[model samples]
Target: MRVLMVGWEFPPYVSGGLGTHTYELTRKMPHDVNITFFMPDRGEVSVPWMDIKRIKTSIGFGPYMTFGGSVLKESIIKSVEDYAKEVGKTAKQTDFDIVHCHDWLTVMGGICAKRENGKPLVFTVHSTEYDRSIGNPCPWVMDIERYGINEADGIIAVSKRIKEQIIEKYGADPGKIRVVYNAIDSSSFDCGLKFKPTEDLILSLGRLTLHKGIDHLLRAAKIVIEHHPSAKFVIAGKGDKFKDLVEMSIDLGIEKNVFFLGYVPQEDITKLYARADVFLMPSVFEPFGITALEAMAAGTPTIISKTSGVCEVTNNVFKIDFWDTEKMASRILEILNYKELFEEMSNNCRSEAKRITWDDIAMQTKDFYESVLR
Candidate 1:
């Protein structure tokens, strides 16, 4: 089977999980299943297992918008429009069984490919506009997302929560959307020896966006510090929320307790996972939380939001509502103070991570493709 997969990010240049998903899934796919991945030419990105087509765009639209700058909505839409035109021309000439796209950014290209080649278009909803904007989504992005959702022959949602969101928000057919859970490359976390920090370290890694609920985590950190003064909270990764979150930490009087490390590199991510006492993902509405899985694979006890799609598969990690800072703090304290609880959760989560692998995910994805074709 040949798949013309359209995505925005990949390894090394990844701003978030979408890139990692595209890279890992393509890597693990069977020899018989060939992928021709299309992406913006970020830089030197190499994937030996599959063919990569890098289309250069005039505009600079990243995975997540950086802090303090207003992103012109018109520019981004124009960039996607140009990219779709390019992709459509390619799809008309190239031979492929299906057009697969990830997120809203690439769906236009996927739709174009479907139109040009008359092949089945598979739209993968890693997230929706509602998830990003926390219920107040941009109408332009929502329109594009809705159009793709309606046009696609099949849809793949990263989690059941996302599947439900598409049905509820866009009125997509429930039967057409397949729930495919995201998986981690456990070996990346397995390579390093566990390093315990002198202080109780609570880590939050991801884009510091409004929907990420980092603000809630900051509130929880203050409570955790009141009980455990020596505990430290680290917020890694960058986004438009950086300055606001910094000020919020100061206002909450947890500035000393919290350390904001802006944009940790992919190579250093595993090291952060290994050193932390606890990993927290307090997302207001996450389709799937991949960082939590990475932390688990590294044997760090994790606390995630009940709204996170990972809650569907997770058993050992503590699940709390994003707004419940009190409970979030309590869970962090319990993990830090009780060695037995920490070890059990950590070990169990690592075992759980082992069961969820890219190979298995690839097989499931391939099966889905075949089903869609039939």
Candidate 2:
């Protein structure tokens, strides 16, 4: 089967989980199926059986007479029309069997491609803007999300939480949505010999955003410090909330205990996870917390918000409400102070991580595609 995937960001240009998902999905898909990845940015990466096509989104005159080139800056109507034309051209040239789009950024391109090719369109909802913004609704985003969900022949939600959000917020048919949990590349995060004595490291990985509830984690850190003053809190990743979170740590008088390690590479992240005794994600709202899986894979006990989707998969980790700082801190201290409990949860976490892999995810996604085509 030939599939044309429309996505906004591909690795190196990635800003969030969506880019990682697209890159890994295309890379690991079976060689029998031909996949073409279309993105806005040009990058130098290639995959077997997958063609990475960078759609030029620039507009200018001659080489020297250029003013400004913005293919995506066109009016929504013109952008949609242009996308429709391009899709018709590509479909005539390639004769693909399916048009798959990831998220709302590529919805216009996907809709056009689906209409032009007369093939089944599959839309993957990594997240909804409504979920990201909590209750604050943006009509434009909601409209686009609804259009993509309504147009697709099939829709993929990363978690049941997100699936319900789609149905509730956009009034999508629940039956049409498939819940495919986000997977991890375990090979990239090798679980070597377990460390006998890990440092007092508590790690949190992801964008430093308001919804991530980093403030909540900092508050919990303050409580945890009273028990284990040597404990250190490390937050990895960069976002608009970095400075705000740093300030919050200072305001809480835990600035000395908290460390903001911004945008560590994947290789370095594994090392950080190996050195950590526990991983905490106290997100106000998380659809599926992939970092918890990574930490678990590294043989570390994880503490997640009860509201997160990862909580649905494993019984090994500690879970608490995002608002319950006292309970969260108590759980962290329990993991730190009690070696027997920590060892048990760590063992369980390792076992749980083995059950999830990108290969299995690829096969499941392939099956979904085949079912949609049929």
Candidate 3:
């Protein structure tokens, strides 16, 4: 089957988990399936296995360009229109069986491609503006999301939670929505890279935003420090709440213990995972937490919030509510103080995470394509 995928950013250019998911899934897709991923002319990607097709556009296609700025509304509209026309022109020559869009950024393009090519359109919801928005989201974006849901031949949600949200928020039919869990590329994770820990490190890596619940993690950091003074918390990734989270750390008197490593490069990720004593994921509304799997795969014990979709697959990690800093702190302390418990948890997590592979994701996606075509 020939597939055209539209996404905002590809890996190496990604700001978060969405890019990672796109790269891994596409790279391992069945050899018989032909994929031509469309993105806004980013430089070369790290993975050579996937067939990536870059497109030229005037809009600033930074990682957060579509989600930010004074000209965001105009930029998104213009970008979508441009991509849609581009796809329509491409369809005149090459035939494709499906046009799949990864997020809201590419939905308009998907619609245009389907309209022009008369091929089936598939919309995958990695996240919704409702989950990411601090307050009321841009009505325009929400409207576009609803349009995609109504127009799509098939809808894929990264998690069941996102599936439920689409039905409730947009009145989407449950029968059309398919819950496909995201998988990790465990082989790409450099298990050979080893790092010696100078301090007992606690890591929380994700976009530092309100919904990610980084502030709650900071509050828990203070409590963990009170019990284990030597433990250092490394909060990685960049987002809108960077300043607020930094200030909160200072206000809570945990500045010394917390390190805000903004925008960790793709290379340094596995190193951090190997050195860290534990990984923390305190998301208020996580569709799926890929970092938890990364941590577990690296032989690092993971503690996630009960609300995370990763909890559906992860068995050994301690689960706590995002609001419960006391419980979060206690869990962190337990992982740090008790070596036997930590070792046991890490070993079990490694075994479980090994079962989740990108090859399996590709096969499931291929099956979905077959079902849709029928």
Q: Which lDDT tens digits does candidate 1 get at residues 1-374?
A: 99999989888777778888999999999999989988888888887899888887764767555223235766787888988888888778788998899888899999999999899999999988877887877787889999999999899999999998999999999989899999988988964444444569999998888889999999999899999999999989888889999999999998999999998887788988888899999999888999899999998889999999999988989999999999999999999998888878878888888788999889988989999999
All candidates in order of lDDT, best leading = 1, 3, 2
Give me the runs in candidate 2 sitting further than 4 Å from their true place: 58-92
Residue 168, candidate 1: alpha-carbon lDDT: 94
lDDT of 3 at 370: 80
Q: Candidate 3 — what's its lDDT?
A: 0.82
Give lDDT tens digits, candidate 3, residues 28-96: 899888887777776775456545767676556543322656576687678777876775666556668
Candidate 2 Cα lDDT to native: 0.80
lDDT of each: 0.88, 0.80, 0.82
Q: Judged by lDDT relative to the true structure, which candidate is superior, 1 or 2?
A: 1
Total backbone collisions, model 2: 0
Query: What digit string (tens of lDDT, one per residue) describes model 2 on residues 1-374?
Result: 99988866767765577778888887778877788877653557565557777666532211011112344234443544454456456655666889998876677678878877688899998777786776775566568789999999899998889899999989998878998888887656656646535578899998887788998999999999988999999999887789999998989999999999998987798998888888999988888888889888888889999888888777888889999999999998988889988788887787778788877778878989998998
Residue 150 C-alpha lDDT in model 2 = 95
Return the TM-score for each candidate structure.
0.96, 0.90, 0.94
Models ranked on TM-score: 1, 3, 2
Identify the leading candidate in terms of TM-score.
1
